[model samples]
Target: MAATKVLVVDDSLTMRALISGALERIPNVEVVGLADGAEEARALVERLRPDVMTLDVEMPGISGLQYLAELMEVRPMPVIMFSTRTAAGAQDTVEALRLGAIECFPKPKVAVPAELEKIIAKLGRCIKAAKGATLRKAASPASHAILPQIEWNGRVLAIGGDAASTKTIFDLLGSFPANCPPTIVVQHLNEDVAAAMVGKLDMKVAARVVMAEDGMAIEQGSIYYAPPGEAHLVVDGSVPPRLRLLSRDPVAGARPSISVLFASLARSVGADTVGLRLNEGDDGTSGLDAMATSDGYCIKPNPAGGFELSKKTMTQAIIEPELARMVLKLCSR
Candidate 1:
């Protein structure tokens, strides 16, 4: 297997060295080149043809977000962003992800040896996961134009995905009407990132988006995101189901596990549940299977395009505006 080549881009000399050094320590990764700014990074990218890139969010002259937008337009490739864990930085990081960056890592505050090691390990894993990830230009604003209204059928919509599915989630949710059915999302993210994502979605999407809180009622016309941290978000088997934050060990290596969420919905809501699996992995399959057993509708993206509903396939891009039309057909009263 060929090594995954990486380019490190940051204006700070120390950060450039630190990122390059960490990437070099990974077993199957090679730091092909390092650049201090957008111009140098562009030249290096043309020369090195790196498989992935580590980009700093804030750089002098052309900012990282600006550079990322340009790069996605001209030559799309996998990019991971590094940013400080500030309120503004978190929002910017979410924007970068929405713009096609594969992942975002928070820059270490103290740079202690122990914390650095952990960050390096996680960064290596992210780079490996990003090796063959598909990068596409951001969808045009027209793609998010509002969809026709539909009355909810008292069905709960549950969506689950990992980091790679952020854009799909944004696209799908953005097209939803302000009065769409009750929706719950479980995207694999850390606490800070999850909070930022919820904020971003609430601002941009027509539907109201909020982080799921313990004992919050799951109501129609609102979207709830499972907050990532010490608890798994589950639905209590109540008359108008309410969200429950259950503190337990991580299931399938994820807290707020998608499997846990789907299984809970299957048990509580039965056929009234609809599940969308966005990223393929073992993490969410078990719960999806449980949903299937309860006669709940299950949908996932087909690699060829469109979506798979139960065993049947629909041939249309899941991220297109058409998706809202299809989902409405499935869940409308």
Candidate 2:
């Protein structure tokens, strides 16, 4: 296999060096250039054309979050964020993920050798995984455009996706009408980032969007995003349907296991549920299977402008207004 080329971007000289040195030590991984901020990083990205980049969420001139938004629009490439663990940092990291970054890791607070080793392991893994990620320009309708009406369906919709599915998620949610079905989503992301995503989606979609809370009533024309990180969001199969947050250990390595939510919905609503699996792999497939077994309908978005993996196909899915239109047409039937 050819070596993976990486660009390291951060304001801290120490951080850049630590990340560069660690990445270079891994086999078949090469650190091509280093930039101290988004301005420098942008120039380097154009000049070097590195396979992947590690970005710091906070930067001097343009913040990493700002630059990522601009980058995904023009010269899209795989990006991973190195962020601080503070509350503000967590929020910015979440924004970055929503803006299409492939992964986010908390910056090491201490630079001990052991901690450095652990950071190195994480960076290496993220870099390789990101190298294989597919990116496409995001598509959505103008904020002021009039949205057409849709026949309200009482069927419930549940979606599960990974980091690569950010744009897909935005597109899907944006197409819903004010009377769209009660929707739930389990997207594998940091809890902090998940909240930001909910805010953004709410702004774009007619449906009211919010983070799922335990005991919150599921209502039509509203969407609930699953909490990420160590908590899994599940729905109690009771009349009127209530949300639950669990602190149990991760299943299949996902704390908010998609399978857990899918299984719960399968048992609860069965044929009344529609499961949409977008840009996810085997980890989410089992959940879709559970929904299918329970007589729920399942749909996978058609893959579009990204590198094709035999495992997961990439597509704009709901991002494109036409697909969004089609989704509503099918669901209303």
The digit string of per-residue lDDT tens for model 2 on 45-70 reads 98999999989887878888888888
Query: What is candidate 2's TM-score against the reference?
Result: 0.83
Clashing residue pairs, candidate 2? Answer: 94-193, 303-314, 304-314, 304-315
Global CA lDDT of candidate 1, please?
0.86
Off by over 4 Å in 2: 111-122, 139-146, 229-231, 246-248, 301-323
RMSD of each: 2.2, 4.1
Stretches of candidate 1 above 4 Å error? 111-114, 140-143, 311-321
Clashes of 1: 0
Question: In candidate 2, where is summed lDDT lowest over 10 consecutive residues?
Answer: 306-315
The whole-model lDDT of each prediction reads 0.86, 0.76
- Residue 269, candidate 1: C-alpha displacement in angstroms: 1.3
Residues 1-333 of candidate 1: C-alpha lDDT, one tens digit per residue: 899999999998888877787778899999999999999999999999999999999998999999999999999999999998898888888888888888888887765445568678778888888888766778743468777778878889999998778887888888888889899999998778889899888988888999999999998779999988899999989887999999999999999899999999999999988898988777899999899889888887676666677722322345444666777667798
TM-score of each: 0.93, 0.83
Instruction: Report how far off residue 74 is in candidate 1 (Å).
Output: 1.8
lDDT of 2 at 45: 92
